[model samples]
Target chain A: MTSSVTASLPRPSPFHLLLAFGSGGLLTLMVDFNGLVGLYATPFYSSWVAHGTGIVAALAFLALLRLRPEAGAGGAKPAAPLWAYLGGVSGALTVILTSTAVNSPLALSGTLALGLAGQVVFSLAADRWGLLGMPVRIPLLRDFAALALIAAGSVIIIFGRGA
Target chain B: MIEAILIATLAGVLVSLSRQINGRLAVSTTPLVASFWNHVVGFAVLTAIGLVIGALWPAGAFSAPWYAYLGGTIGVIFVASGSWLIARIGAINTAMLVIGGQMVFGVALDLVRGAEGHVLASALGVALIIAGAALTQRRR
Candidate 1:
């Protein structure tokens, strides 16, 4: 109920961390794919409708969690900026834009590949410039190399689809 | 193709930005509360757009599969978990891990669906992504 039972455990081991991070990524992509597929399949259901429905589901889940009194252990940290609260707007934009693009000739893998490129670029920039109040990190040479590898890998995955 | 690329790229940026914002918000509020606000605001924004265009729900909306409506639910989890993970592992590290995991899962999905994609190429890409993620891990 409290988001995760893992939350109360000791600091996660490396394996636990890996599982959490990877699972989060996988879940995100699955949702994206599902939403896109649904949007394309039903002309009557706009991206808005699909997204709105998903929100309803999430709220329902949250409500169920709240019914469990044992599930509320996440202590709130210090207050964040008002901008932090605006994430939902950007999230809506992501859903709409992605749904539209994927429905186009770009296809799923291709659209995902391009999106990955953008994600990597924006993530690196965020770290480098401390944008969005994230901590600044001076990327190492290896970091650059890593980014390049990721980019190449994504391209291969997209073009390799041979569609 | 070009338009798709542009839209995808923009969407990617928005996704990253949204994740960052949600991460910070989670720090101040519980992840559930943060997630709720995210959906509430997102729904509001989309409703506003639908209003501007004069229609919130297109006809035949009831016909879409139940799974399609799960994106928002999945998204709530992504934001909540991402918010938690990013705080622990820093943004870049978290991003790398997520990307790596997502690519692997995507490839698996394609394979399972028997999509006629290039398996070898996707394998290589997944490998590179994993390697990149490992390399980016901060040297303790």
Candidate 2:
């Protein structure tokens, strides 16, 4: 679980950075829509519906990518280990756990903030050790500095919500 | 309180773990393919649970505004992009940048919806977030 952090730092390309950031925007939208579903039904029902739709959407996207201008989903690739295919189980479990926590005294704001902390901590270790087959990256002083600023801003936004 | 905190935190952990695992699959297959598997597998599991619990058709779920159902479509792209980004940028950068984006965009969404909040705090928070993102984009 613990591996020595890498020594050197490599900058992310501009394109990759944009994609990552843009995807975050997509997340906000996803959460908003999914939460609406939850409000109408149970969170479990909400998640189940989303996943059901997601499967159909994924198929559409895969077809588009395969047919279009420059997408490359072709070429035979190695068969994924069984464990690699279990990401959805992790995702499904998240919905249940989060639903329960949100119903608790922690509420949405607290749950969001704590979830942020968990994500940050886990990713730090993930980058440090290259957990789950990612490239190892040792966060440097600059990285910590950036994190501090983002964390502060996030805390303010989260706790400062709704009047 | 403690239980809530732990569960909330664990939920976050699972979010990252799911991405990491999907990313690994993406390494072998394309990110889109990984995302497909993610949705299909997740749908299957949820279906089983829904069957067992018999709560699949809970009241009012169907009447949710049409737009709500679109979240699943958006999620396919979101999960695919996360898988792609994690393998390319490493997890920390991906997480930081994505969270920053979500926060910034969330505030924007709130503003457009005319949601109430402390304006000064919102501005300050946004400023800090942009600055943090700039720091992230700094040349290594």
Candidate 3:
């Protein structure tokens, strides 16, 4: 079941593109706010606070969603395994590791560059192997082109800020 | 230097790892449900670490402006969006597009705040990223 080859889905619609981009923008804002919190409090505290607040926000949104049932909500999904819920552990560890790297000789720029590389490598592998229960996708040529351009652009932005 | 580099790279890997895990949960449940668990569980773990290390209540922990505390609110939406996108677009597309957006938006944010930097390099970087995004939109 895990090794099944699923055909590539239709290309992402423009709406998905927009949402993905907007999500990244949300990330910028999140880092900005959390970074501020970190300055006054500990990094752990900042993350903890974000997670705590996230719980409230999620609960509120979940409640609101309950009021209005979604259209085509679809049939019941298979239950997620216990380990599927451990994503937070990976996230918490990221904070600890990243903070340690930021203070090292790598500084912010080095860390950013290397982190970008790491993400690219892992994401490619994730898709190739369908790791972690996601679907498998045979990356097309355009995918590599996209990755190169974005990675190049991100690196420039990272180093250019120092200029 | 080596250890730090490895750690930084590992951190990035974990970013994808976290997203992948949460994405799985989102598949079984809704994205928002997965995000909720991600945050609450993270909160629990961090709280334990903070207590163990005696860093739970730092100096002036509550002194931040009210708006500064809103990251998690945005985060709920952000994580949910990633979970939703990854399944549809696959991990690489999701990661690339989002990274592009973050870089482009970061420069825009800096500019908005009147931050200092070489505008030329930023422009070049933004152009490259935009071109890259266009490639994804192109249907063969």
- Give native contacts recovered, as a fraction, per prediction: 0.59, 0.81, 0.84
Give the winner by DockQ.
3
Which digits, one per residue and each the tens of the lDDT, describe model 2 over residues B5-86?
9999999999999999999998888888888889988999888988998979999979889999999999999999999888
The value of fnat for model 1 is 0.59
lDDT of 1 by residue, A20-104 (tens): 5566565756565555655555322345664566567666877777732124334554656778879889977886787788788
* Between candidates 2 and 3, the DockQ winner: 3
Model 3: pairs clashing at backbone N, Cα or C within 3 Å = none
Selected candidate, larger TM-score, 2 vs 3: 3
lDDT of 3 at B132: 88
Please tell me which model should have the higher TM-score, number 1 or number 3: 3
Indicate the residue-level lDDT of B55 in model 2: 79
Q: Quote each prediction's TM-score.
A: 0.80, 0.93, 0.94
lDDT of 2 at B4: 91
Better lDDT candidate (1, 3): 3
Chain B TM-scores of the candidates: 0.86, 0.95, 0.97
Interface RMSD of 2: 2.0
**Against the unseen true structure, what C-alpha lDDT does each candidate score?**
0.69, 0.86, 0.88
Task: Estimate, for each residue in A105-147, the C-alpha lDDT of model 2 and write its tens digit.
Answer: 9888898899989989999999889897777888877788888
User: In model 3 chain A, which range of ten residues has the least summed lDDT?
Assistant: A1-10
Off by over 4 Å in 3: A1-9, A67-74, B138-140
